[model samples]
Target: MKCLQEQAADGTHLLFLAAVYKLLYLLYTKDAATVDHVLRHRSRRDFERIEQSMQYVKRNYTNPITLKETADELSLTPEYFCRLFKKYTGQTFLTYVNQIRLQYFHSDLLQTDESITYLMNKNGITNYKVFLRSFKEAYGMPPGQLRKKQREVRDAGAISARSASSSGND
Candidate 1:
């Protein structure tokens, strides 16, 4: 009570008061084991929705995915869905979708010898410039460079193992 009174007396401390009010509001409104339980319940539901959307995107990354469609699937308004998604996942819906698409692209790069143009097209990225920029920003390297380096590392390991085996045999 004294802290609250002191906080109310000062304008700068009002922000802390507001934060405390919000926390109390949440605490009074919900009942569970702990704050972690409340948060984890919310997170689990959001992640289940995210996982469903991710699966859909994985199957349809080569096609258009409007926010409306995803929101509808999750039974949320587009605006609210976007806000909740960003709050829980730290990325906008489209950005998270692109991240999933990029993961697919990364998997392909690791497993297949597909050309970058093919990848961009396969992933429904028509703009080469935008694809390169987003891919590099997300993965910290151009797709081509990443694949090249991965190949080099794989080959070097194979060569080292072969050399070791031959020396041991001799």
Candidate 2:
């Protein structure tokens, strides 16, 4: 019985090692064939499901979008929705929502003179510190710094264009 137990343990370890090896192999290969296979075989139902989820994300970014809300929209359980979302989009729902918020924030920085605090409040970001940290992580710079840099670039470009037009007139 002891020997049988030891053999079972060894078998489990071997299975774990095999799984690790297979994962490494897939990563090394970049697995284009499998990815293409999945994409090519994706059905209309899959596309419709993803489209609905994306629409929900876009429309509700400034609101508290719970997993339950998304799951209900798709008639899926939260767990199943999470798994399907990650599998199809290579991003979890929370990560995807943050990406959308970051994109919206970046555009607002370029186009508007809104206060950062106001933007945070408007975007459902309650924690200023966490918002700053996550924004910096996503954008490689603080929001204020990015806004300042964008303004400088825009001003410089405008000045250069004006000078070039004057030179052409001369």
Candidate 3:
């Protein structure tokens, strides 16, 4: 204040420039902090939205789930929702949905003797090619092969158990 008043008295532009520079520096520092705080808040909110979208996917993945419908439920545009989903999950929406379906398919495959085609359809997988590709990608083998391997292990275990039981009986 004193310097500016003195500058005004002398009509010197130097002091005016200095004051302007100081004001700008202070404003910039304050604005940067404000921007950071806002970004943190926005980031937390965005993550919450992403979580909500995931829950929505889990609930509806057994049926036909569209990106647009999920986005609409969250009041976000499909494009933005897709971007956010991929950014957080490292997978696109359709891929995520198919992943969930594949998980269900894997569980059913292990627990039941259902045909692969029937299991795929039951898990909402409509495209045979896509299902085969995704399943192989996920499990490193086709569904039928995995099932066969599991059965082989089971049979081996059963045979060992039976032999052990016979020896014990003797």
TM-scores of all predicted structures: 0.66, 0.68, 0.87
Give the lowest summed-lDDT range of ten residues in model 2: 38-47
Model 3 lDDT per residue over 1-170, tens place: 99878877897877769899999999999999999999999889889999998898788777788999999998999999999999988999888888889999999999999998888878888888988998998999999999999999999999999999999999
TM-score of 1: 0.66
Model 2: residues with Cα > 4 Å off, grouped in runs: 1-43, 168-170
Which window of 10 residues has the lowest lDDT sum in candidate 1? 27-36
lDDT of 1 by residue, 13-53 (tens): 87877899999888876754577697898788988887787
RMSD (Cα, Å) for all candidates, in order, is 11.1, 12.1, 3.9
Better of 2 and 3 by lDDT: 3
Candidate 2: TM-score? 0.68
Candidate 3 differs from the real structure by a C-alpha RMSD in angstroms, to one decimal, of 3.9
Highest lDDT, which number? Answer: 3
Q: Between candidates 1 and 3, which one is better according to lDDT?
A: 3
